[model samples]
Target: MNNMIAPSILSADFANLERDLKRVSEAEFIHVDVMDGSFVPNITIGAPVAKAIRKHIKGIMDVHLMIQNPDMFINDFKDAGTDYLTVHIEACTHLHRTIQRIKEKGMKAGVSLNPATPVCLLEPIIDDIDLILIMSVNPGFGGQKFIPYSLEKIKQVKKMIGTREILIQVDGGVTLDNAKEIIDAGATVIVAGSAIFNAPDVEQRIQDFKSLML
Candidate 1:
């Protein structure tokens, strides 16, 4: 897959979401971080918000569910116009079944791993999913520093994937300073939040990231 930027809306201006989204409209995908307090210690938007967001952008909607029981919301998100439904592997009881349900719902299925979750554990269902999301920082909150170890993890995932046509997405703490390094490490799709939205020139910041993409 080609290198792509998925700008996370977690750092966008909630009061002016439409305007903020327009700023990063050129990005390949718009990442939605859906958090439920029980799973991630913070609560964010839900399917209804996603449905509303769908009306504004034509690009891919990469919805990352940081909530427990993600399977129950599969169809909800599908109806909300989610192009990709990413669920945390740490949250699912039956990961394979959840992935199948997502595919059955006509949406691309993605599995996400926390910072501590090793790539080797994903082997059993690696071939079954469409994408693998690597969390560079802990979930729930945004704007945390990217863990240095994530780069090595990304390389490991790349080697483990070998020739499989799977997207390796790195989320959290992505900035212009370390983006190229992360991409070089094997992250196909990058999930950046404050780094892009909090910049003085949001669109230009996104372009800067695009320039670094493969």
Candidate 2:
């Protein structure tokens, strides 16, 4: 499978978001992190910011909603230029219904799991979604240490998804140093924020990560 690099905007310079977005134009997807203080801790951007930056994204607009009652905003995000909408299983009371609603809005749907969520929990809905975002660090913040055991968790998710074409995405604390191992464990999409935007040369840092894709 072809691997992809999705640069997260959570670590972007909010004051210079449009400019920061231009820096990672080389990435395969622009990872939009929509956070609500109730679900995690920090409150990030909403659909409006997503719409503002949509024009600058060269590739897919991968919107990950880390909030409660995600179904209520599915239509709003779709209208905001979200090409891919990922909702947290922990947040969705009726995941299948939420997935249907997202697809109904004509956007590709994905599901995410917190670091503590088990891979088996995905068995029922594995085939229904386009991607599975595996969190390597605790949700709610960036610049944190990656959990060592997530590698094995990725492997387990791979086994559970055997032969399915669904994409395996790894987010949180994904840096160049451990990216290879994460890919080897079956992550097709790598979501990095600090590892890319935090670099001295953001574009070059994105390229360095892309260099390892093959």
Q: Where in model 2 is the C-alpha error above 4 Å?
A: none
Total clashing pairs for each candidate: 0, 0
Tell me how far the alpha carbon of residue 203 in candidate 1 is from the true structure, in angstroms, after superposition. 0.8
Assess each prediction's global lDDT (C-alpha) against the native: 0.94, 0.92
Query: What TM-score would each prediction reach against the true structure?
Result: 0.98, 0.98
- Distance from true location, Cα of 95 in model 2, Å: 0.7
- The true-versus-predicted C-alpha distance at residue 84 of model 2, in Å, is 0.9
Candidate 2: C-alpha lDDT: 0.92
Residue by residue across 39-68, what tens digits does model 2's lDDT show? 999999999989989999989999999999
The per-residue C-alpha lDDT of model 2 at residue 180 equals 92
What lDDT score goes with residue 143 in model 1?
A: 95
133-182: candidate 1 lDDT, tens digit per residue: 99999998989999999999999999989999999999988999999999
By TM-score, how accurate is candidate 2? 0.98
Q: List the residue pairs that clash in candidate 1.
A: none
Q: Which whole-number lDDT from 0 to 100 does residue 114 have in model 2?
A: 93
